[model samples]
Target chain A: MSEGSQGLLLAGVGGQGVILASMIVADALMRAGHDVKQSEVHGMAQRGGSVFSHIRWGERVDSPLVPLGSAEVLAAFEWAEAVRWVEYVRDGGAVVADVRTIVPPGACNDHRSWLRRYPGIDGELFDSRHLKTRLIDATATAEELGNVRAANSVILGTVAAFIDIDNKHWEAAIAHLVPKGTEEINLAAFRIGRDVAEARVPQTAPDPEGFSGPHQIEINHVWCKGCDICSRVCPEYCLAVDVDGKLTIIDAEACTGCKLCEALCPDFAIEISAPREPAVVGNQAAADGSTL
Target chain B: MTDVKTYLREWAMPHVLCPGCAHGIVLRSFLNAVDQLQIDQDKLAMVAGIGCSSRLVGYVDFCTLHGTHGRAPAFATGLKLARPDLKVVVVTGDGDALAIGGNHLIHAARRNIDITVLLLNNSIYGMTGGQAAPTTPEGALASTTPAGNTEPNFDACKLLMGAGASFVARVLAANPMDMTKVMADGLDHPGFSFIEVISDCPEYFGRYNKVGGGAEMLTWMSVRDEGVAGPLAEKRFVNHIPIESVPSGMETGVLQREIRPVYAGVRKVEDHES
Candidate 1:
């Protein structure tokens, strides 16, 4: 590592202005009489994918990439991204993160439980790393300033507090880089963000009630005409008709309570009963809880 | 959520519909909509005329009235006017609503009364031994039209929309969730809500047309969906039915919704001003 060089990382969802914020940081660093190099990945920006940028500044900056556990600070625009990029920050470094959550498409695999695969706001996770964490609702602050799009400026303002750069440099870069006519709100958002307090971290949400286990599938043999409709419509392939023209439960435990078979059955012979216990206990809990 | 079975008359289990019939699915979706709306069973009324679709009213635990053939809409209109507090729903088959009771159905829609009409169009009179119904696609084989009927089929949703129905929608039995959603919207509508459910009769229509069983019929119905309704210029399948007479694609979703004064009863002089 260089004697006087410092690295910073910014992480967020694709459309959260991660690249623009990185550019502003680099510009401000240059204005502070330091050589700066910045690199970013926004290939999946339009698809709501992860976006991140690395900025390094010093007397003579070389590599724009911030090595693992070497960054001085980490700025994250979303909650999940904060946890994702927190490892890059060195011990005792600072983390500026917005408490906003943006759930990706892949996390919506289990529609039956209706529980999002998202991490809760837990400060203990950062405490384990011995890092300073500042969680703020930048979007709400920017929204109060009249435009929600100025949220990135608010985040940049908090990030500015951690860097040893002058306020004039940040305001100049923000005013010069942001879209025309949005300068006032963005500057106001930055000013408010500089003095913003730590937001109240909400407690971990409890598992939703009523969905305890696999739904109970009951079939009335007398009413079921073995028409093959219910068996074919079952997404989980839980029901199947035998050669003798009788409905049977082939995979009872796989039922997700989608109710497709129950709703499509022609004879009203199938009924799905909700599970009596909570499905969130033990091994069946969402993977996000244990991974974080 | 309350069990949908609670809304049904358990003794009426094993409905009289033929094997592989889609009416049962429509019934289940309707019950789901009713359950979602949380309408009190005692305060809801199910009116039906004589047909396979009409038989659905008899199985529900709500206040039901099985009227004469093709007169379900007339009965529903009277019941709604007499008891404005009750949520009245008329379940009728294509043959019952579009043919036998077509006049009453059109008049009820024209008047914009507060009632929901679910016209289950199976394209044949399944209860009457597979006779050709008014909604039977041209060139389709029915017991009465073995030589392929020369008469054209009726687009039930278009007819209702043209008759000034405040809310009009068409849903396929293949998509039960979408069917339930549209049914819920119709039930919540204020005046003259008409929903045409494209159901299948595996024993009758499917067998006569060689359209396979219930599963195949459902797939075929799904393929006919012309996407959600939009502006007339943006519609891909503008013509109701293609010239090939094979029952071309049709728009499925809320086709029209208008806020019109509902016909409650004889309006007073001051009522017109309001």
Candidate 2:
């Protein structure tokens, strides 16, 4: 850790132009007459996996990896990724995160409750870390400027406000790195980001009613022909056929109320009933209503 | 969100279709479409000809007519013409509509009558103990063709499209949601709506062709679909059956839709004077 040396962290999901944004940042830093080194991990980026890059700049830079709790700022392209990499920023460091959520495929494993494993957009979490948080709807701003793909440039513009670099270097780097025809749009998006106001973060939504318990799966044995359609289509594997070719509920507690079995059952033998009582187990925040 | 069971004749529970037969799913999807459209159950006429698919009309609590083999279209056309307010739907099988009642089916389409024909093609004559039918793919084994039929199968969608059906579409039992969507679209179409549901006869077609059970048969159908890929398309269901036995590149979803004049029959004297 040398004096005047600062690290910047960028985290986002795949296909969000995380690598391209990092290259633009490093290029801007180079144009600002600083020693800049950038490294990124994007092996699983094409499959909608997590992508991150570490950028460090100073009079003399040794490593591109930004050690934990040493970054001056963290730019997250998605809500979940913001919460994931917020710890990397030092105390009182800035965090610029877009209020966009991309629910991953792995978060859908809990088929019993149908509750996503994503966190809510609560600024209190960052407040507890004693860090300066700047939430912005960069995607919306970029979309309003006529192209949603310029969202990363908008975020880079916001990051410029925190760094001591002049706007001319960022403009030059954006013009040099952006696609052949999108340079104008990217430049306009950057100016909007540089002067953008803090977006209003909404409160966490209340949990949906009548989702406290697993749904009840009723099977009419008389109508069921032991076809194996319901059991096979059940995402939770809640139903099965016995040795005597009779439908049976092997795991009633795992029913997610998805009703795929009930929908695809040929005999009308399967019926999914919601829990009889609307007991409030706990407050689970719903997904944010923000959109790009 | 009325329960589809409300439209069913509870006494007819446990339908006579064979185990793993997809006709039950088709019936449920149809009831869903009817419920979505909010059609009056009494004003809805379901006509069926003698076949495993035709038996679906007997289970529904509607103005149902069990007609002679391959004559469901004729019955539906007559019913629609007499009671123009009623929503007439004909449930027929591949053999009943394509083989035995081919003329009536084509004539109904040619007239551009306001009747929805849901031709459930299981690719075999399931009601007659798995005999070869007109829609049965070539080289597929059936009771009548133990050495594999040396004939080409009929593409039901193409046949209906060529017959001047204003609305032509195909769906599969494997994808019930899309089936419901296309079924609803067909019911809403004004004239000659023909939807061919690629249902599965696991007891007959699956066992004879070694395509596994109802679940495997659905996976096979989904794999062979050339329409927009769905969630089931990505699943690796470990199919061991030979590739050539099952038909491939069969496109699903709505194939054609057009606006045309509907055959409303002879108008009354008061209607002409007005």
Candidate 3:
């Protein structure tokens, strides 16, 4: 909402819904009035490799990259990744992390002997140095409320508390970002994550100049075969991919009317247009939901 | 002497081709051959069937016909018969030349009609979204066959030679100079000359089969082309050494050349007099 930008880092191993979680947070930031710039590590994403999303939001964000140790928030989908990306967090930045620990294979040949030799705990995560940390059992919370897949949503909600945005905006983001039928449980997971993180102090406020405008551009999801070509070509780094590998808008406000994405699309799936008055949701049925 | 650009109907262009398509190179080679020969443009008649390569007939400044699907040879036969003085050429894609039009192609070669056939082989039916064609390589993925095509492909050059074509050559789109030379030679050949161009359809075929787009496909073709594999080895090894063997790679040069009796539906005056 101010002159300066906000940097957030999202890190996780592949298949943990890290990209989708970042998409939700980034979309909500744009709706709350900032020009969001989002970028992700797409390589080695299918092999359970380290993945990170760089999200920056402001009136006029110049770059999609977050310089090392400059991020205000680092949301880790797993405790091991929490320790892995802890160095990226600014000294005063907040970290909302999943308490679940996933040890890489071969790290400990025998879990029983390793558990006895070194019990896993917060302090075991080599000194976090001065960065503020709030570890949450988001997986337990999500599974208690019916779907372990919503663990990503719970972690996102936990991170939502450290950032300055209304609960309603987060609700709207979940509705627009998540698939159709799973909205109810995912929202429940979000609320649980927020309640779990209520003890922390929010370091920033929603941008007073944040984009409270309509979404521009319509994608004929029917033509989108989950190709990353459009997302890679967006001039303002506004397009992002969802869990299904389809393109989802991250910062519609950052669009400069450049039709490169539309023109380069092999399927002609993207169409740039003026924002509608009603702020209609995008082609929500995924590509299968399009007019095949 | 008209150049290739001059031969092109400027108003009809620019020719629609997707990024990374080999069809452009093949089309350019054909135009370059026509340009090099300084052939009579007014007397040139080109017939094409329905497909991406068939669209070539619409852009060339010749007496061109483009509506028939897999029946370009049938149309070319009629054109050559009616105006025996015209230098007629038929262009078709793998599907058009070897599938629905297979019979027409074999018959055209059998009769040894005085015409040239340019078979643009991209391996799959590209215009219809990467369907498996008769020329599609075995085990390659197609839209209709998501689990890899189980059917084998046709070797157009061998098939044409078996059907008694007077001139048969196989060329690659990557080697434009050689392709043009073969094209010009085919045009100059007296009886049915069939040139099979190993071209690429990157949008559909390349995408579905995981083949690197046009450039990579071209690079592969260039490397796969082991030049002049058949004739010389046959002369040196088989006839001289009394050995029986065949070359391993795709034979590149002209496979066959012979003088054949042209079918005109009637005996010539010399034959009648004799």
Candidate 4:
């Protein structure tokens, strides 16, 4: 996966639809012929605490979680929380923050007033662009859309246009997730955000399918134990052991495409293969028991 | 004896649980019920609390969740609320249910949400090395109750029945035959069904009580109440052992009542204004 296609993070205080926004991005990625993994912290969010969701996608994804400092873009629904999760973004990554600061339970009697004077949060720690932040009046946009509930969806639209994901995939995902009767307001919110994001970064290019990122696994053969334990642990059983118990990957085609073997290999002797479009069944084997 | 191997998740190893523990029996009965019902395997959510009995989900397939101690009821409650169409089952031991999760269980029954709660009762706590539990017999010896347990045990069936559970019953794990029926009935019944399995904790309860072994314990349980030993017995029996052999309706277990409060205590607020 390309650094741009590892996907984005969505963060906010409670009640904001950070989870829903992440889901929307995941669905869009899926529709664009990429594998996507989305994870959210559920039970704790209702108590008025910061909420964040990790959205990771690629031609292939090994885990739902994104390691910190890998997010290509961040859609921060709250100012303070934006600062809190800014570390998720990579250096030079973009942040589309909603300027409306929500008062966490004990901030002050006049949190709204304090927020107006709440000097901007720094973004350099994650190597992200500080001055390039897009301040969106998402609440105001939702109000104009006739319902404040559509704010997250509006923010997602802006995120879509800023990232490489296709706008149609985002729209399709909205259609799939939203309840039967609430399509119009959601689509409207999506359009508002998409337009905002597009307006901010006019030169950004849309991400194409099968984009490869710089992250790659390197093998050190000198450290190899040759115990063949990695072959025994492979879930896809992609490993083959010879009479001497030396390990070798057999029919890498049989690999369910999970890197568990590589990750768990005792001797860091297994390396990641070059980026190639994952093969569909037709070319690999015949329909019946016979090999192609 | 239902084979648990077929229903268990392929990767789940039988590494946990104690020997002669009734948790295995309850878990087997639950898997049998799911199999018989032809439930959508993917949609079945099994939530568990902390205890020897609660660890049973590690051996089951489907979406198994191991939550905090005594919080399976609350966690299952939230899961059921979020996805009403899914079949949600909460499995917890006596300590997990009666001690820490008592409020959540009672409120869950009061609400009568469409969920099943299988409460495994082994007289004493087995996970933390057999301390005196709420369901421990008054004279039972435990690690914490060196002399003997002074307090009375809580009849969980009575509590749930009083709280308006649509279905409530109790069965013993020694009687695998009856356990299958009881568990099946609990899973099929709508609203909140509370089924308490009088499970065994041989390493703890047996050694403390000097009950030779699980077989001896089963024999003792079988012979305790022979007065109700009749055809189509008016009382519940496990493995033909009348564990709770008192007359129906007069007993604490085997209760079926009308629905009351449901999920998260969120009644149909006339408007969405709450």
Candidate 5:
């Protein structure tokens, strides 16, 4: 695991499955056993307004909301939205943006004219029409996979390729989160995305001083409701309840604080806290998603 | 009851709520009702209007509809009609339900849809800087009503009963015991059931009315009577004269002994409309 935290922002208009895509990424990270917290804003969504999600995954996450200007990955379904949140990405952060610009209302008399003002924004902008970008088009891929409604799954697959998480862990998380009868298509989309990200992302030298030291806990009793939801959705089966009805952490090392258990609990009796406190520092990274 | 601590998301959950806000109490009571009845988790649908109280839907994990201001009844109506198996509950503030959505409430009660309406009447609109609401007391001062409000307020339970609601009751948010009981009973009612909860808006209504703090607001509610009325009472008004007068044809009492035939019956005639 990296020593520092990783922040990702998912931005798009409502109904573009931005929330679902954000969930998929967060789910994959949790499966890899990384600490994560995600915050979603969706009020007045019926009016077709802009929507954004903040995801912080790594060592530990406290506040679900990330402070401005700390995103390492900014994935946008639309081009203008990508520019809108371009300032959040830290220097050297990766941005995998879609270039299929759908002009928002009041941008201009025409949509194309409205889109011309965006290239000036920073970061490596990938044309959404790029062959690699096909994985980002989950809506199209869902249809190809025999269900037009599974488009959000496609974008998740595209995002899988960029982060440092493992692919099998993500596959297992998808298998857990998604409904049955649609696993094959989602896995295919995810594999394609991994291949693309591996091809495009440059390999960085690993930090010798990665996360280390006394950051672990021994929870005596975990009163999980025996609902297979956690076991099903977890990429790592770190969660288990012994015969005595106490929940057990099978692999404490692999329990990411994604708080998916908190989100999905029907009875609502699970708690997960970050193992370590996070520190903030000043950096001169360009506001755009780049390594300038 | 599901322990609130366990159900809540651990993230610094938004502390947007003001101290001693009635919306929180209303939300707690609501959760209690659902827990006590053991309502099928998947079958519970909540509809909310726009107000401090309406925002209650945001924190909850159920299938919630944060519809437009004052249109929760209309939305809940459509939701219940489409999915008859689902138990729909509408939570609205006084302003949202009586002022802007008065017509929807009247029609829903008149049609008697199998929906439960939790009307949180704090007598002021807390979300929009504490303005005068339809239920604001005749002489109560508000942000909009500098001197005092001159308009009469609607008695939600009485209005619903007169509009043909099958079940009606009123309780104060201060009395969690009775409030939870009334909520459960309303949800169990087979037709449009109206339960008006006298909630305390400590931030706006309380400070403006000089009712002290949230605890003081609850104290005010504790002294009030449950205004129970008889069935054939010739003109039982919601308000008493001398101190102040507001015209409300609703008397405090149960209206119907049994649930009358409603839209569901009409649907039955048509073999159920989807």
Candidate 6:
């Protein structure tokens, strides 16, 4: 009930694990001895639709709702969703948003060519003078790391770093809350997010192409969702993900040009080019596409 | 794990269902039935309304869809009529099917449309913080009914049969094998098949009424005898019809399997009789 209590809002499209991530955060906060109150909305129009969770924590909390313009944190799962709900962030509050953009189907319902008329989303929507922002390409990062679904965990990690909670409690909550077999990956994502926040570094995974061989695979950085399936399934052990979570070819020659990476990519970002003469490493000049 | 993984959308695992919610059990049982039946995933259409149980459609990797709250039957009816080739199945929770959807439920059965409806009856409105629902046991405690639910609750299986469904069965979440068997029977039935999954809502209903958590409720359900649908079981459930008229001996496994003409895509006898 205190005026200076902590309040956070988690917003994302449905099937994005909004409720689960919020629950994990609530658990961590409650274990840290803070009174936590959480409210959520679940229903029929959820699949691919907008969803949100409201969490409040402090010495003593009253209502679960954070009231307009009073939240300390606005953790969003997509870039556009951050813009849609950035109004709730209190002055000086931080917005931790995933850089992915998901345009609702209704927005483009009428016209197949609406993008030409409307152009694209503004990348600087959350860059207001008053509000602090930490945007992460969590989907790409998690996917590139082997699981695009870990974006929620990665975002939670990033959010946890900005908050005052200790690492021990967060770990405990994640271990208890996350389903079996995903603890390590989620924990790694949490740590990566924490490191990004603590270091205040812009995420840029060093060029994925480390070593070159007779066969070359170029990954369009913009299009990759960063689910690490390619790296995990790669027989060559030549692929490695960078800190930025954009996939990079760590060992090029090690790749047998198996085309497995290209086959497994959900985003179709990997292109296996038959042994190029000059193996161009990092700094993808032709990398700008829809993948980002 | 392999068996379920084939049916489940694994990415959506550790579903939104609460810790002790029995909806998960019923969901697994249904999927097991699908696996046992060797159903072609592409030829199957899964429809659901709003509730915890309805969300099961999301996890099933099939031609699954979600309709508006309490309108799944109508949507399923439309799907069945238009694309009779698809094996249409409807999943709904207590509030969704019985309260707002009571109209569609009766009509779907009356028409004998070929659709399998798995009504997960958790007594209270589990999604809406446990308000009293049409299927909540009379005198049962709920958040809305502080003093206890005063109104009677309808037995969905009986009501579906009374509405002229060709196949009807009542099973519990605690008994997965029986639930799966009955579910398979319902699915294989030519006409409208209705299976009532007596579910548990430990968070809202149990916490309010002091019954117990999900495990305890499952234990209670497990010990109860099946196939003994005599006056004792009849007394527990509420029906609009008289007790004398209500059939005793609801033989549990598959209560009804009558050979009736299906309504959908069926020609009238008078039109073809020579």
Task: Please give the distance, in angstroms, between residue B3's alpha carbon in candidate 1 and its true position after superposition.
Answer: 2.5
Better of 4 and 6 by TM-score: 6
Evaluated against the true structure, the overall lDDT of model 4 is: 0.67
**In order, what lDDT does every prediction score?**
0.84, 0.85, 0.74, 0.67, 0.64, 0.73
- Give candidate 5's whole-model lDDT: 0.64
Off by over 4 Å in 3: A1-292, B228-248, B265-274
Instruction: Compute each candidate's TM-score over C-alphas.
Output: 0.76, 0.78, 0.45, 0.43, 0.43, 0.44
- Runs of candidate 4 exceeding 4 Å displacement: A1-292, B1-4, B224-253, B257-274
Going through the candidates in order, their DockQ values are 0.38, 0.62, 0.02, 0.02, 0.01, 0.01
Stretches of candidate 2 exceeding 4 Å from the true structure = A1-5, A14-48, A53-69, A98-102, A111-130, A134-161, A165-213, A275-292, B226-245, B264-274
DockQ of 3: 0.02
Better of 2 and 3 by TM-score: 2
What digit string (tens of lDDT, one per residue) describes model 3 on residues A34-56?
Answer: 79999999577676667889898
Which window of ten consecutive residues has the lowest lDDT sum in model 2 chain B? B265-274
For residue B13, model 6's alpha carbon misses the true position, in angstroms, by 1.5
User: Which residue runs of candidate 6 sit more than 4 Å off their true CA positions?
Assistant: A1-292, B223-251, B266-274
Candidate 2: pairs in clash: A266-B25
Supply every candidate's count of residue pairs whose N, Cα or C atoms clash at under 3 angstroms: 2, 1, 4, 12, 6, 18
- TM of chain B vs. native, candidate 4: 0.83
Best by lDDT: 2
Q: lDDT by residue for model 5 over A1-292, one digit each (tens)?
A: 2346778888877777778777877888988888988999877555656788999888877766656666767777665676687677665565665444444444422222333433333323433312223214444445666765455565666666667887787888878776687777767765655554322111121111222211243331233344333443344455665676455667766554554443333233344554565312122122222331
lDDT of 1 by residue, A143-180 (tens): 88888888998988888889998899999998889999
Better of 1 and 5 by DockQ: 1
Query: Judged by TM-score, which candidate is best?
Result: 2
